[model samples]
Each structure stands twice: as structure tokens, then as C-alpha cells.
Target: MRNNVQPSNLSPDPRADLMVALSTDQREHWQHAYGAHPHMYGDQPSAPALHAVEVFRAAGARDVLELGAGQGRDSLYFAQRGFTVQATDFSDVGLEQLRDRAAAEGLNTLRTMVVDVRDPLPQADASVDAVFAHMLLCMALSTNEIHALVSEIRRVLRPGGTFIYTVRHTGDPHYGVGIAHRDDIFEHDGFAAHFFYRYLVVELAEGWHLRDIRAFEEGELPRRLWRVTQSLTG
Candidate 1:
């Protein structure tokens, strides 16, 4: 767990505004979610993602890329495991806290950088031995944009390089919960927020073949999460 992590005055919630919640109209939901519960996001990498990382490591992946590594939980874990990892995200605050946690844990080998996956990836083609998108590609993107991201991963990875990631399901109401009329803004707990999500069609993408697809609809009816895996087929 990340000790001394700063907490924010936000609430954990699932607003009733469905359309806006999943769209960019309410994307900052994550910021607030992490702000309200830094430890939850900082220490607790998703269960499916964690399991996937273990499996990848067992399969001989060493160098790793974490696209949306919040608070460096996964990054530090990989570094401690002796795998070289470069984790990137657009949130400086999140990365700073991640660094603080790493410093506290004495895992100085972990590398954290500020990179936005929406732009061109910062590494050279075939540079990384393996890539971990985690929960990155699913955020605030159109279907085509998400496909482009997958394609970009393929382009960057060397032959036989692996790209691991997870996509939220289409039925997740929390994904696009509340949005303003313009569809780019949302209001929650008396605060207005901005957000987007367009990754409901990962099963239809070209190139990569599905390795493991887990359906997580066992919770409160309609379920809220899905786990999908892909292997780069060049």
C-alpha cells in the first residue's frame, strides 16, 4: 500500500446520468475517483490486470510498458520483480504521487514519465519487449481512435512482442454516466466535470487474436467490467 498518500475531497459514486457518465462529458470521474480514494487507485491495480501481468511475466516478458499506470502500483511491482518498466500517463499529480510511493518503498529502479497515449507513443518502434496498456485505451476515445491505438501498439512492438490491455464493457453505465447537453461536460456532487469513453467494440478490431476474455458480470446485475487479451500477430 502507498503510505502517506494525500486524499482529496471527492466522493465514490455512480451518478444516475448514464449517457454523460461514460462519454467525455463526465470523464474526469476518474480524477475524482482517484482523488477521493488515492489508495484504491494507487495500490490496488485491477485484479484481472494483475493476473495478466503475472501470466505475462511467467511467459518470459521482461521489459514492459504501462500506458496508464496510475500511482505506479504496477510499475513498482514490475521493477521489484526485476523487469524494466516505463510507465506513462498524462496526469502529473498521479505520477508524482506514484514516485513518492516508489521512493518510500525504495524501488528507485522504477521509471515514471509523463506521456499521453492519445499522442504518438514516446518510445521507438520495436523498442519495448512487451507493452501493457492496462486500462488506458478504453478512456475517452471513439471506436476508430481506439483501433488506431491498437494499431500503433502493433507498429511499435517488434515481431513476437506482446501488447496486454483491458477494455471496459459496453453495458457499464458508470463508464458514461452523466453528461451535459453538449456531451463534453458533466455534473457530479455539485461539481462539473469533463470526460469521454468510446471503447465498446474491441472484439471487432483487426490483427490481434484474442487470448483470454473474461466476463465480470457477477456483481450487481448488468455487471460493470470485462477483461480481454490480445497477442500481436505479425
Candidate 2:
């Protein structure tokens, strides 16, 4: 594991008002957003997700856990590729859509669960071979909450298991465009996001081996993000 990246002191916004929890209204915002379209994020797996499948296959992993698996595009993709996937998200409507699609495809290897990533994940410790999340950590979460979630992920992953995630980086064009909740957090049109810097990524992977951090841009928004992969040190 390389430790060449220096840590930075960029902290969360200190404003009390800005440190609010991800409210039901925010959940409703996502629910309504997905409900508005037949498929909000589209049917294709994200670039990072496809990359994760390649990495997991290379590592010989089979049992995969997906966080914030909205509409289950990636989860279904994993299932179709013969991985047993536990797909989780906070949105019932989204999970229902995923379930319907998975059922229609006869993806018996895929399971859906309604879960809030801010809370302790409902999974057994050291059970899963790998965990995957795409842009889930960049949601409306405090720095402390993110740390807790990372700890939870570390606990649930088996020894030497891998965790792959993607997040909008500070380099993204939309980083500071909206109402400032904090230094790195912004709320735009009722959608809140916390952007990640490379230093923050290093900080989050403190207890793990930071395998790689690759940059990519995609979508009509042309979102700029980092695909971060980490592994548990056995």
C-alpha cells in the first residue's frame, strides 16, 4: 500500500444549520425524481460499476453488496454476470423498480433491501466478498457520518475483501455552484451533495489499503468523479 499522498486540512463547514441530517424531505426528493421518469439513471451500468465488475472478477469475488443501488442497473448487471448481489437503497420506489426488473429478468441471485447508508448497515460482519457504492458517499452526509459508514463497510467486508466506490470530486464543475451548506457541501434545487477531494479520499481509507484512485467524466452533466478502490489489510 502506498502512502505517498499528503493529507490536507479541508474540514466540513462549521455552520450548525448546515450540519442537518438527510431528512425525509430529501428522501422524498429522490423518490419523486425517480418516480418522474420510467428510468431516472437509465438502464446501463455506470462506468465505475462496470469497472468494479472487472475488478471483482479479477479478484475472484462472488458475493457482492451494493449500496445506494438505485433502480438496480449495476446490481442486475452483476447478477447477470453470476455474482450474488445484495442491492440496497433508501428509496422504496427505486427498490421496487429494481425488484420488478430483476424478477422480469429472472435474476434470482439478486436481492433488494431498503437501507439508509447513514445508519448501520444490516449485514453480518466479515460476510461479503466485496462491497460497491457509486456516488452514494457524496450524498447529504456529515464528515463524521461518512467515517461511521466507512467503519461499517470495513466491518461487514470479509478479511482481504475489496470496497469500490465512486464520488464527485472537488474538481467537478458543479462543486460550488449551489447554495453553500459548507466548504464542500452544496444544496442545489433541494438536492444536497458533499464533494470529495483526494485528501479526503485518503482520510476515508485510513484503515484500509488504498489500491487506486482513477478519474472519469460522464453523463449530460458531464460529472467528474474519482473511482476509489480499497482493500482490507488481512
Candidate 3:
């Protein structure tokens, strides 16, 4: 969220255009990354997470379900803000690190789980107050999987629940640069990301009250992203 991070039109990586297949499963790549670089994304909550706290608070949300919550930076922040938090990720290594931090801090309001967004959420219908997922929907999931995940989010959320998410978009420098997967996904280095088009966001919000889509940038790559906020109608 640093203002002086890479600019919007930063030079693209020279190797980004390589068409080599991303042979390794993304799960393995993430596991190895977390093993090699514990707390890699650092401890500070993301910009989107900071924004979500205010939105959730004003919406009177008391419990939070955070998907793809790597290392629990945002989840810990939510718990510290006095909201009950369920933090989940596909990587157990990352969640373990998160759990240790939560335990050391005595953050009893925070809990961690290993979850793959492609599957149905474990929560019962109309159970959670709000959901947050920073840069999760843009992961290697196909369009169908992403749609299904949104449906699952809807199922788990209580009426009038807010969901805030961010995604790298077609305007990103790496969008058309790497190995092509189905849909708009492309692999750069070992990570595969599904770059969103604006239309896809609209389609995903069809059943929800689409509240906002704010453009933002993140990381040294200065990934162009959309921070979307939508809410379920009571």
C-alpha cells in the first residue's frame, strides 16, 4: 500500500512472455514458498484488509470469514479489532504460522483452517457475518470455479453480509504475458493468476448488491487490481 511502490506502467519482466507450461501444481508452489519464506507477505494487513475493517464495522459485522488468509495478517487484525475470525488457506504451513502468532498473542477470537476455495465452505447456511479475500479470487481458479466459490460465499454469509475481495485485472502488465491456461489465467514464474475483465466482475455480482469496484495497485510489480465490495440483500 506504499504510495511509492512501482507505478502503474512499470516495465514488464523480460521473461514474462515465455510460453512454458506451469508444470508444478500451484499448491506445491505455495507450500514451498511458505516453507522458504515464512511471513513472506509480512505482518501488516493489506490495504484491502484495512478498508474491510471499517466496512465490516459499519455493517455491524461481529464474525468474519477470511478466505486465502495466508499467515493471518488480516485475520489477526480483525480479531484484534474484536471480531471473531475464521482464517483459512489451502496451505497448512501458512496457517500453522498464523496459528502460532495468534496463540502467542492470545488472540482467542481468531481461528485457522485449511480450506480450498474450489470446494464448498464448511460453514452452515447463513452463518457468517462477513467475508474477506484479498487477491484470492484471482488465483489459478478457472471461471467456473470462481463462480462456484462466490456461490459458496453467498451460502455461508448471513443476510445483509458484506463480501470484499480484490483481483488482478486485465490491465496488469503480466496479464497476457505468460503461459496461458484456460480462461484468462496466465502463469508468471511459478504462480498462476486469473486476470479479471470488468465484465466478469459484473457477472459475479449478479445476485448481490454490487456496491463498489475501486482500482488499486499493490506489490513491486504494482499489480493493477480491482477492490470489489458487494453485499447480500437481507
Candidate 4:
């Protein structure tokens, strides 16, 4: 993370806001965006992804695992804050850019790897202090995949480590992103995308207790996005 990247109280984007609040058309846009630029989406940190750092920080997390850490935004932010951050993402191209960006910003605390979140993490069991994913899971797999991934999360976390996340909401239509319905399905960049405003309460399965949950919807153009967030703690 760059030493100068502070948590700014910067204003939000209206387009992003609309998508979050009423994003039935998001899948199409994202697929298009990814097709156009496979290395990144929107060239910035995701709205909920940014907030996860604060969630951990406020919860007093020291070491963190950022799963599906595409651009290294959350990972770098945590690293810059003195947290030992292990950032993981599956895209080789995305990870390359992340490494390049990290190098340019001199963020070494962020140790990164290219791995599928559906598989076991390259970590010792019960070793992490906290785990976080921002809008990463639902975009990657089906509800069945979510359960398996959640199982993996359970295996890596300490008996009482925290898991924090934000995911797409099902049936939100105002955002103009995709087909709004239960599965949070959408069409994007020529590929089919499916996701939803979803939640899973797995304790023993995830190796933690559900601590808190919050949801955010795109309020306006400058602040568009729906964020379903939570803290899982020991």
C-alpha cells in the first residue's frame, strides 16, 4: 500500500451508486468492463471492499487475509496500516497488475498469490486473525459454490477469527445493472453473470460466530452501490 493512501472522506460516484441501489444491469456492465480491461474493474477500489478495512480496523484486527483481493486495494490499505496482509485472487493478469501496483506503491506488507477461493487457501489451519471478501464470492460461483467456499473459510480461520464481507443483493432493480431476481443474475460483457444480495450464517462451518451485519444501497449517483456487510468473530 502507498504510505500516502489515506482513508479519505472522498465523495462517491453516482453511476456506482445507482448500480448498487438499483443494479439489475450490473452483470452486463461488469462483463463488458472485464472484457475491455481484464486487469481491473473501474480502475478503483470497490465501494464495499473499501469499507471492509474499516470494519476490521475498528474491530482491532492485526493480521488479515483478503480473499479475491483483485486490485490489492483492501490488502494494501490494511498493510499500510501495519497489518500483515495476505492478498489472494485468481486472475493471473489481475494479480500481475496488483503486484506491479504494489511494487510501485512500495507496499510489501501485502503478500499476494493467485488462487481460487473455491479451493483451500495456502495457509495453516486456524492461523488467520480475520478474513475478508468484498463483493467477490457471488460474482465467482453459484450458491452451492458459496457453501464450499464458506467451508474453506472455516478451515483457515482461527477458532475465533473474524470474517467480514459485502455481497450483491438479490432482486434490486433500480441500479440498472442486470436481471433482478432471486439468484441475482445478470448479463455482462457478453458473458452471463449471476449473483444476489445474499448472506450465509455458518458458524461451526466457517469457524466463527456471526458478529454483525449491515447492508448499503446506492443512495444516489455520487454514492451508488448496495453493500451487504457483516463481521464474524470468535
Candidate 5:
């Protein structure tokens, strides 16, 4: 297990006023969640992230762009392994915590930024060697937004670059349990989540080469997830 450190008091949580949908308000919700606790999630690198490191190393990738990098666990892991990492999230508090952790660890290769995946990424075309997002795609985004995000990811990646991400699958026990917001979206605990089906994966892989798909579970909730890996065509 990784050691947990106390986060700085960047801001207080305002979860009481936050909404559970895909809007600017959702950003505050995440910020509140991260601020309310010393650590919202574990410090250990997620399984898909660990797998991505091996894949990227084998592909001779030295730079990685991580979307929705909540607490920078995977970013720190990659930085320790000598990969330059750009870690982004919408939560200001989360990014601040990540910056603190990176500085303390002397991980100069890891940089944090406030970014919303629903918007165009702040990156140059073909600038990154790999793109990673663990459970970012399953957030409260519409189908169109997911497509746009994926397109942005593909645009920023170098030719033959890898894109690795994980998302909650429809098979998850939590699917359709909470208040239904849309077709596959559900709201619970002041957050909205859009679950994905296998067919939706196919739809998302329109331009990229779908390399692999694997199912796994994690956390006390045993959240079912689909780990997807795709490659940009040369």
C-alpha cells in the first residue's frame, strides 16, 4: 500500500450546492470531494495505468499526457519511471494537491494543469507519445462529448501513439441504480456517471485501431470497468 499524505487546505468543499450533471457545476463537485478528504482515492497507481506504462515503454514513449489526473498517482508513477507527464483535471484543489506531491517528491517531469475534458485539450498536435485516462470517460459526459474528447486526444498524440483508458461498463452493479439522468447516465452521491456498453466502445473506436479490451473490478464497491487500449494509425 502507498503512504497517504495530508492534503493542503486549498479550499473548502461546497458539495451541498453542487449539482450531479455534466456542467461547470460538476467541476465544483469534484473540487469539493477532493477538498473534503485528505485523499479521495488511493495513492497506488491504478491497474490500467500500470499496464499502460509497460505498453508505452515497449513502444519507446517518453512523454505521456494524462487526462482527469485526479490526485496524480499515475502521473507520479510515470514521472518516477523517467517519463515526462502532463497531468490535467478540472478540480483546482486536486491539481493543487498534485502539484504539492510532485514538488515534494522532486518529480520535475510531472506537471499539473486545470483542464476539463469536455473542452479542447491544451496541447500541440502530435506532441505527446501517449494519452492516458483512468475512468475519465465514464464521467457525466454525453456521447458527443466523449467523441470530441477522443478526437482531441487522437489529434495531440504522435503517430502510432497509444491511448489507454478505463470506463465503468454497463455490467457494473451500480448501473441504472440511482436517479436516471439520461439513457445511460445515473446520478448518485452528488455525482453523475455515464456508463458504457461494449457497443459504445465500438462506436468510440471509429478512427483508431482498437488493440485490446479487458474487464476488471476494483474498490470496495467492486466497480466493474472496461480497460481499453487503442493506437493511432500511422
Candidate 6:
């Protein structure tokens, strides 16, 4: 973790009052959760991250950018595999823990950044070789926000850059059970998730070469997800 990383604040959005409110609450919830339960997700990388290592390596990727890197488990794993990783999340508490672990492990290839995916990415255009986001696209983001975020991902990735991300899909058990927000968003136990339908995935991959969309499950809730892989033309 680098010392110069600055935290980003969620700016109010006049267009979507509900989105801004939910995002703010979600950020605070994640911070408090990480503060109360350090290493909550444990040190092991998620199955998607494990799979991403092979995908990234086969694509000859070196530099990686990770979004929603809670506590950096996957970020650290990527670094361990010799990929230089920039791990980012909205929660500073989670990122601080990530930085401490990276420093303790002496992993110079890994760094942390505080970023809210709703905003334009801080990276320059075509700056990274690969991008990974494990269950990030499903967060409380609205449909338009998700599209905008994918646009930013495309902007930051180089030609031929592999982009892999996982999202809890509409098949999830908790999908419609929680407090409902617009655009398929639902809040359960303080975490808001915008469950994706297959059509949304296809729409997001319109111009890119969509390699795969594999259905999988995670957690005790068995959160149903689709791990999507796509790439740009070299």
C-alpha cells in the first residue's frame, strides 16, 4: 500500500437522490463492518480471483487494477502471482487494513486506492493491462451508473486488456426480498445489491468481445453470481 493514496468522498448527485443516499449508507456500512470485523472475508482470494489469475496470465497481463477490493485478499493474491496490482475500494477502513497487510508482507507490487466506482476512474486512458472486480458490479449502483462504470473500465484498459468481474445475479435468493430501490436494487442487512439480469450483462458487453458468463455461487446465502470475462481487440 502506498502512503499517498487519498480517500474519495461521495459527492451528492442531483439526478438520482435515492442512489446517492443508498451509496452513502453503503459506504458507511462497509467502513463500520470492516472496522468491527477485520479480515471478514478472510485472507484467501475469492474463487473468481483465483480464476482471474489464470485468465490474466494467459492473456500476458502484468499490471492489474482491482475494484471493490475489500481487505485486499484478492489483490494480495494477485501480487503474490507477480501481477502489479492497484487495489481500490470506497471504504478507507478496509483499504487501511489492506495497506497494513501489504506492508507487513513486503509486497511492493501491491498498492491501495480509495475510489467510488460511480465517478470516473482516476487512471489514465489505457493505463492497465487487466481489470478485475469480484462481486463489485452488483453493488447499489443504478443501471446507468453501472453502464458508466463499465465505460470507465473500458477507458482504463489497454487494447487487448482482459476485464473480469463477478456480480450477484437476479437468481440470488436475496434478490427481491429486501427493501427495494429502483432499478432492481434491494437492501438486505444494510448492504444494497443491484442484482443483474442476463440482458444487462449482454448490453454492457455490446462492443467488447465477451468471452464468458459462468454462473456460480458464494457464501452461506449461496449468493448466485455470474463471472463475466471480456477483452478488447489488440
**Whose lDDT is greatest here?**
6
lDDT of 1 at 218: 29
Mark the regions of model 5 whose C-alpha exceeds 4 Å error after superposition. 1-21
Q: After superposing candidate 2, which stretches have Cα over 4 Å from the reference?
A: 1-22
Better candidate by TM-score, 1 or 3:
3
Candidate 4 vs candidate 6: which has greater TM-score? 6
Question: Model 5 Cα displacement at 96 (Å)?
Answer: 0.4
Candidate 3 lDDT tens digits, 98-168: 99999999999998888887679998999999999999999987666688899999999999999999999
Ranking by lDDT: 6, 3, 2, 5, 1, 4
* Predicted candidate 5 versus true structure: per-residue lDDT over 31-92, tens digit per residue: 88899874777788888888999999988899999999998888989998899999999887
Candidates' C-alpha lDDT: 0.61, 0.86, 0.88, 0.59, 0.84, 0.91
> For residues 37-138, could you state the per-residue lDDT of candidate 1 as single tens digits?
667644655566577677677667778888888777778777777787787876666777788888888876678888755567778888776777655655
Minimum summed lDDT over a 10-residue window in model 5 is located at 1-10
Steric clash pairs (candidate 3): none
Residue 152 deviation, candidate 1, in Å? 1.6
Q: Which model scores highest in TM-score? A: 6
TM-score of each: 0.71, 0.91, 0.89, 0.68, 0.89, 0.93
Off by over 4 Å in 3: 1-24
- Ordered from best to worst TM-score, the candidate numbers read 6, 2, 3, 5, 1, 4
TM-score of 1: 0.71
**Please, what are the lDDT tens digits per residue for candidate 4 over residues 141-215?**
544556667777777877556677665444444333644332344644333334443233332224345555565
Candidate 2, poorest ten consecutive residues by summed lDDT: 1-10
Write the residue-wise lDDT of candidate 2 on 1-234 in tens digits.
Answer: 223375543465465354554445578888998788758888998888899999999888989999999888999999998999999999998999999999999989999999988779999999999999999999887667788899999999999899999889877888888878753778778888888877788899898999999999988888899999999976
Off by over 4 Å in 1: 1-37, 40-42, 180-205, 217-223
